[model samples]
Target: MKICHVNLASGYHGGENQTLQLIKQQAALGYELTVVANPKSPFVAAVRALPCRVVLANHYFAAHAASVTADCDLVHVHEGRAIYWALIQKLRHGVPYIVTRRIDNPLKKKWLANIAYRKASAVVGLSRDIVAKIQHAYPQLSPYKIPSSPVTYPIDETEVNDIRSRFKHRFLVIHAANMLQHKGFDVTIAAAKALQEQNANVHFALLGDGKAREQLETLAAGLTNVTFCGKQSNMGSWFAAADLQVHPSYTEGLGSVILEGLNSGLPVIASRTGGIPDIIDDHVSGLLIEPGDSQGLATAIMTVQANPQLRETLCAGAQQKLTSFRIEHTAELYQKIYQEVKSSL
Candidate 1:
């Protein structure tokens, strides 16, 4: 099978990483793969390192469609903006395309989004809830649910020990998201401060960086329980050492970091928004609190930290539920979608 992944985002983030993992997993299965990405983007660098063909185009929608789409049996659009390029590829060249909508945010310019999905071979949402949302917005289209890559690496013992020794709190929590408002940086900071005020033996490390760092830091002034550990390249080590994962995002398509935490055998307490509930089974795999509810978040963390048996139960549940989110598993499902798109040709 020949597949081309078209992404226009310049910077590599969660969605880009998920696309890279998809291409890598499919390439390993001996399928022909190609990527259309920005000439200077980090994604192109990673794609070039693989066996796939790299068509360096800022937007394959207008300038490079003929070069990248003429021969490919199907194009998989990896971003919202890339859908237009995929649409052009299909309408102008008859190249079939599939789309993966990775966010729970309401679709803007509804008519345009409708046409885009309507033209695609398949619409994939990273979470089932996202798929349901799409269905409600555009009932004519059938969207599938395919979560992002799960924890693919084993825990590095050395790195784990290093982190463990550094932040030796009775309970170590990891809030792994870019420091942005929607990611709930304020909520995490408040929860951490509250936990500290209550004398809870806990420490939190915010693992990713973003534009909101300075503001969040200012908000968290004088709080000793939270540490901002700038952008981390290797999250596996952090997860391996953390006792619990706290993700209080205001919105998310599917929280990939939450999956990593569960796979690492740590409990998670996340906001009840976006695709989080898809990964966390409210008190089963991990606890769930309403978005922006710092008090509830603080309570969940304290309760989990105080009960070792509950921690063990939640961790065990996480392991049992994590298999479905693995990269290999996700790729296998997309492989079927690719085949279906190809068969339609």
Candidate 2:
């Protein structure tokens, strides 16, 4: 099957990574693929060696005029703006398209959005919560719930030991995400402060950089236990060395980094919102706390820090949970959707 996958975002964040994974899997399965992306996007370089074509267009209008979707069997829109590109292709050439919504934010009820969604062959979400929100916005649409798969990176044991060595006699707690308000960096900092006040040996390592970095750093100031590591390229080593992962995001489409922590055998303490519950089984695979609850987050961290037996149990459960979220499984599900959408036409 020939598919035109559209993701015009410039940066390669979680959503872009998921798109790359899907394209890689589909291409390996002998499916011909064409990518409609911004020339400046890191995603283009990521797919450089793949057996697929790359069509460069800065915006939906440019993509439409370029006629990139003319010969494809179906179009898979991976980002919001790209949805309009698919919509125009559908309207102009009768090409079927599918949209994958990765955010849990409320879908806007604009006229163009309504038409674009209504005309989609399938609307997919990365979590059940996102799917619920989509349904709430458009009752006539039944969106598919297809979460992202966990990506495994090679662990450099030397690097892992080096990271662990920096925090001697300390239990490392990792919070990996873009330094954003919705990502709850402030909440994590508050929890770190509480832990520091208690003179705990736990160290909080805040990874990833964003516009909120300076603000988050200012909030974390005077806390010797908190360290801003900035954007990390070697996440596997950090996850391997960390004792636990704390992700207290106000909202999450699906906790992709949480999945990585779990895959690395680290017990996670994440917020009980969005599709997080779908991954964390509350005290089973990991512990769950209400969003913005700094005290609760600190308490959960202490509980896990004090109990080796509980951590082991959660790690065991983590491995079991990862089985259903393999990239191959995600690809197979999407291929099924693609085939169904194609056959229906």
Candidate 3:
């Protein structure tokens, strides 16, 4: 089937990454694909790499709606602004589009969101919790749940070992996300303090940078164990070098990094919020703690550090569950969705 995928996000985060994965794999499956993404975004490169067309629409209000409609049998939108453009495409040219909502944050302008969801051919959330939230606010709209793909980049073992050796004596824990309040930087800092009180020989490599970095860095002042690793391109290497991943986010749509961690066969200790529970089971695939609970986060870290057997068990479970979150599986589900939506039209 011919498809047009739209994403207006400027940065290539988890949601954008998911879009790239689906488009690339589906294109390989013989689906003619076209992507309309922000011109400034690095995501344009990925789309160009695919056996597809890449239309650079930097603004949400760009005038490429008619052209995008002319090229595809079905339209799929990935992010917020893209949803708005898709709505216009549907209204003006009668092109039906499906939306994938990736955030748990409540819709600010209810009327706008209601119009888009109602008009869309199908709406999908990345997890059960996200679907529930969508259903609650817009009861007329029955949302489906299709999750993000667990895709990790290749890592060189020699490079991974070299990075690991830099922190030889300390147990390294990695937290990767854009430094946002909802991401639970405060909770992680508190846990770090707790670790420090006990003089634990553990170090945190906090990856990704955002507006909250200055404030968080100020709060973590004097905590030498914490290192602000402002956005690294090689997350797979970091996963390989680290002991485990810690994600104590107060809110998350699906926590793609956690899935990436599991994909790398690195066990994770994450807060049980939003779609986290959908991917991770407590003491099963990985460890889960209550959101914003520093004590619980600290306790889990300590438990993992104390027991070598627990790490082995979590990694084993993660490997077993990995197939379910693979990009191939995600692409198959989306292919089914595309067929269903297209046939209805």
Candidate 4:
């Protein structure tokens, strides 16, 4: 089977990483794969080393559709704008296509989304919450619910031990997210401040880069417990060195970092928004706090810090859950979807 994965985004984030993982896994399974991406995107360069075909094209709907549809058996779109062009191509050529909705952005363009859904052979929702939202928005566009398949983000276990040696016995807390307002980095900083006020001996590490970095650094000013390490290419060491992972985002389709933290045996403290609650069973694998609640976040952090046994229990549960989201499992699910759509076509 020939599969074409389409993403026009310029930067590499969870969605692009997931798409790359899928492409690598599927190619290993002996399927022909092609990636349609932006010419100037770093993502395009990253995937060049992979064993798949890469096509750099203009972002125009008509041009991209015309170029992609001719040689591909199925087009799997990973972004909304690309979905529009893919739908147009599918309608024009009767080729089957699928889309993976990765965010919970309010559907301001509901009509356009509906049109794309109508043309798609299948829609892949990364989380059940997103699936519900899509169904609610366009009841006519019934898409399949395939919660974000879990995969361990590339992290080396050896580097984790090295990081632990560097931290030397200090209690480490990691927040790995883009420094965006909606990601709630401000709340995390405030929570760390609250912990420090209470004389807690904890070190907070911010891992990721974006527009809000300077503002977040200002918030962390005078606080000796916080460190902004900027963006990291390898997080295995960070996850391995940390006692806990905190994600205070206002929304998420599914927290892929939470899954990565769990796979690394780190307990997570995340916001109870979007599809986060589905992954964190409060006190089971991780703890959930209300979005933007600094006080609640601080208290949860302190509670986990105070109890080593509880942390161990949660981490163990997280490791067990990791098995369900292995890259192989996610690849198989996509393969099944591709097969079904192909048969229908």
Best by lDDT: 2
The TM-score obtained by model 1 is 0.95
Clashing pairs in 2: none
Tell me, what's the RMSD of every candidate? 1.7, 1.2, 1.4, 2.2
Backbone clashes counted, model 1? 0
State the C-alpha lDDT per candidate.
0.86, 0.91, 0.87, 0.81
lDDT of 1 by residue, 86-147 (tens): 88777887889999999887767577677887888999999877898888888888889999
In candidate 3, residue 48 scores what lDDT?
Answer: 87
* TM-score for all models, in order of appearance: 0.95, 0.97, 0.96, 0.92
In candidate 4, which residue pairs clash? 126-148, 150-325
Model 3 per-residue lDDT tens digits across residues 1-345: 898899999988888888988887887789888888898899998788778888888886786557776968878999988988888878888888999999998765568767888898888999888899888877888888888978778898887888788778888888999998899988988899899867568888899899999999999999978989898888878888999899999999998899899888788999999999988888988999998899898889989988889999998998787777787888888888888988887
User: Candidate 2 residues 290-312, lDDT tens each?
Assistant: 99999999999999999999999
The candidate 2 region of ten consecutive residues with least summed lDDT is 62-71
Ranking by lDDT: 2, 3, 1, 4
Output the lDDT of residue 278, model 4.
Answer: 73
